[model samples]
Target: MQNISNSFFELLNKIQEKKKGDDIQQYFAEVADYLFKHVAIQAGETRFTFAEIEFYYYKEGEFEGPLYNCTYPRTRNVGKFFWHYSGMDICFESSEEKKYFGGILIRSIKRGSEIIAGPMRCSDEIMNSCDGELPYLVYCETACETPVSTIRYGIEADKNQNMKFCFYIEPETWNRKREGVLVADKATGRYKNVSKTDYYIAEPKKR
Candidate 1:
C-alpha cells in the first residue's frame, strides 16, 4: 500500500503532467462564473451563502459534480461561516479511484460577465484513516474530540501578484502557526518541503 506522502506526491505529479496551460485557472473561472450566476444572483447578495462544488477527473476528461448548500445537515459550520463571510469551497476527486485529491477555497464575483477570484488553500478529508505521514493524530484529553493535522494545497498570489502552486501544513493547535510552501527540486522535478521564507526567496519576483 502506498503511504500518504507518496500518494500525495503522485497526485501532484498527475496534476502537473495532465494540466495544460491555463487549465486550472480556467476551471476556477468557470466555477466562479457558475456561482455568481446561480447562487449570488439568486440570493440577491454580493456574498454567497455556504456552498460547495465538486469536480471529478480521470485520465481522459473532467466532469463537474453537483453543488452542495449549507442546508445539508453534515455541512461544517466553519465551512458555512467561511462561505457566507469569505468564499466557497471547491473539491476535486479522482474518478478512477473515487479518491479525494483536495480542494481550493475561493472568493469570487462577477464584474460585467467577467469572474474574478483568489484561490486559497482549504483543508479536506483525504482518507478515512489518519495513519498517513502527512496528517498526524492530535490527542487531547480535555477536548470533546481530537483533531488531526492536515496539509492543503492551492494557488496563491504573492506581493507582486505572481501566482504559484503552494502547500500549507496546518498543525493541530489553538494558536496561529506559520505556514510553509512546497519547492520543486531541479534535479528530480518533484516538490520538496521548504520553509516559507526559502520559498519566497527562491521564487523570482514578477514585474
Candidate 2:
C-alpha cells in the first residue's frame, strides 16, 4: 500500500522507493505512451462508495474497506452497473483484452442510499449520511483495452453459497477510510447486508 499526503507526495515517495533518479519527464512520457497505446481500446467505469452503518449481526467493531468496481461482460447485451465508492477511484489494464478478459470490474464500497438494482442513485435519504454529501456515484465508463487489468470486473462466489467479497485498501484520508471500515460491523455500522440473500448476484456489470 502506497501512502502519502497528496498526489505530489505520493509521486515523490514512489520514485524514491524505486531509487529512480529525477527523470520526471521520462516518467511522464512513459505513462503518456502507455495511455496512448490503450487510447482506442474499450473501457468501463470504476466507482467507490463509502459510508457508516449499524448491522444486526455482529459483536465487536471491525473495519471494512468498501469495495468499488465496474464490469463489462462481453456478449450480445452489454449490461452495466455504476456503484457508489464514496472515496475510492479506479483505473485498470486488461489482463486479456478481447479473449479471456470478460470485462472490467473494480471493487470499492461505501454506505449507499439504497441498493436498488441500478446506477449509483444519489437522490435517496441513505445518501445523505454518506461520507460525501452526495448519495450516488457517477463515473466515465469507457473501453480501453490496455494499461488496465481485465480483472477490473467484479467477482462471483465459488458456488459454495458461502463467500464474501474482501478488500484491502490504502486510503488517502482518515475520514474516508474510517467511514468505509464500519459498515458490516454489528458493533459499529452495517452497509449492505447481502449475507441474507440466497443468490445475491451483484447489479449486472457490463457496458
Candidate 3:
C-alpha cells in the first residue's frame, strides 16, 4: 500500500496532472481515510498550544488571498481546538463567509517510516461514533472539481456522513491566505464557528 503522506501527495499530483486544467475529485477513499486517521487520533489524544489555517478564493481561474479574516489562532486541547466562525462578535474575517465552524484535530506521530491515522480515519468509525452529539459537520471534497467551476466542495454533511459535502474554493489563493481551518480563542467576546454553519467567530461585527 502507498504511504499516507505519499497518498496525499499523489492526490495533489493527480489533481494537477489529469485535471490540471480540468477540475476533479481527489478520491476521499484514501485521502479521507488518512486525514481521518490524523483527525481521530488527534481528537482522542493529540494536544497542542494553537495553530491557524487559511482559505483562498478566485473569480474563475485567477486566485488570490491573504483575504479578509483568513487567519485566526487555533486553541489546541487534547485534539480539541476551539474557535469562532462568525467574526461579527469575535472580529474575525473570512472571504468564505462560513456559516458553521468547527475544528479538525490531527495527531501525526511518526511511527517509524510510516505514518498512519487512527481508526476513525478509515471509514469515520471514530468520527461517526458521535451520532446525535455531532450535530452538523462540514465536508471537504475535491471529487467534484471541474474546468467549468474551478472550485471545490466544503459543504456541510451530517454526522452520518450522508448528503453531499460541497463548497467552492480556489486552490492557489487558498495556499496564499493560509486562513484558519479551525478557530480557537478569539480576542473578541463574539465567537464564530459556534454552529455547524456559523463561520464568523468574532466578538464584534465587521462594520
Candidate 4:
C-alpha cells in the first residue's frame, strides 16, 4: 500500500502528471465515439447525436445512511477516480467536439438541519470538538466495458451488501502507476492528501 503524507486536498487539485505522447487521449476519444454511437444506433439513426448526456439518481424521503466511495483498492488504485470532491469527471473526445461526462451518486447527507459526512452522522456536539480534519469514505459505482474485458451494466443489491464500494477501472496499464500523488508544493513546501477530508465532504464534519 502507498502511504501519502500530504494534505489530500492539495494533492487532488494539482495538475495531473502527463507523459510525452500518451495514448490515453486516443483511447478516450474512441470510447466517446463508441458511447455516442451506441446511444444513437439504439434509436435507429446514424447521423444523430446528443450534445450532452446527463444522469441523475435520487433516494426518496429522509436519507439517513452512510455514503461510501465505491472502490476496489486491492484490484485498482482509488486516487484516479475522484475529480474535485463532488464527482468523477471524465473527458472524452466525441466526434468533432470534446465532451465531459460526470457522475456523482451522493449529493449530501443530513441529520435534521445539519449535514453529515463519513460513517458517523455529525451532530452539533461533535462539530464543536473537532479540529483540523478527518477522512471519510464515500460510495461510488460504475459499469464499464472495453473490447478486451467483460461488459456489464446496472448495480446489484446483493453485491453491495457489505456497504463497501466497487470500482471499475480500465486497462491494467493505467492502474499501477502512482501519478496522482502530490508530493510537494513548490511555494509552501508542503504536501497534500489526495483523499477527501471530513470537513470538505460535509459542513457538519467541520470544526
lDDT of 4 by residue, 1-207 (tens): 123323332322221232334432333334333332332111111111111221211121211122211221121122222233323222211111211122212222222223333222222223333355422222212133432211111334313442212121222221112235666677778996453323433222121
Candidate maximizing TM-score: 1
Tell me the spans in candidate 4 whose CA falls farther than 4 Å from its real position: 1-63, 68-161, 175-207
Which portions of model 3 show Cα errors greater than 4 Å? 1-4, 18-23, 26-30, 37-163, 166-207
lDDT of candidates 1 onward, in order: 0.28, 0.24, 0.25, 0.26
| Candidate 2 off by > 4 Å | 1-91, 95-119, 122-161, 166-207
Query: What's the TM-score of every candidate structure?
Result: 0.24, 0.20, 0.22, 0.19
lDDT of 1 at 113: 29
Instruction: Report the lDDT tens digits of candidate 2 across residue range 33-67.
Output: 33222211111222333211101000112211122
Which has the better TM-score: candidate 1, or candidate 3?
1
Q: How accurate is candidate 3 locally (lDDT)?
A: 0.25
User: What's model 1's overall lDDT?
Assistant: 0.28
**C-alpha positional error of residue 67 in candidate 3 after TM-score superposition, expressed in Å:** 17
* Winner by lDDT: 1
Instruction: Mark the 10 consecutive residues where model 1 has the least summed lDDT.
Output: 143-152
- At residue 10, what lDDT does model 1 achieve? 34
Shift of residue 156 alpha carbon in model 2, Å: 7.2
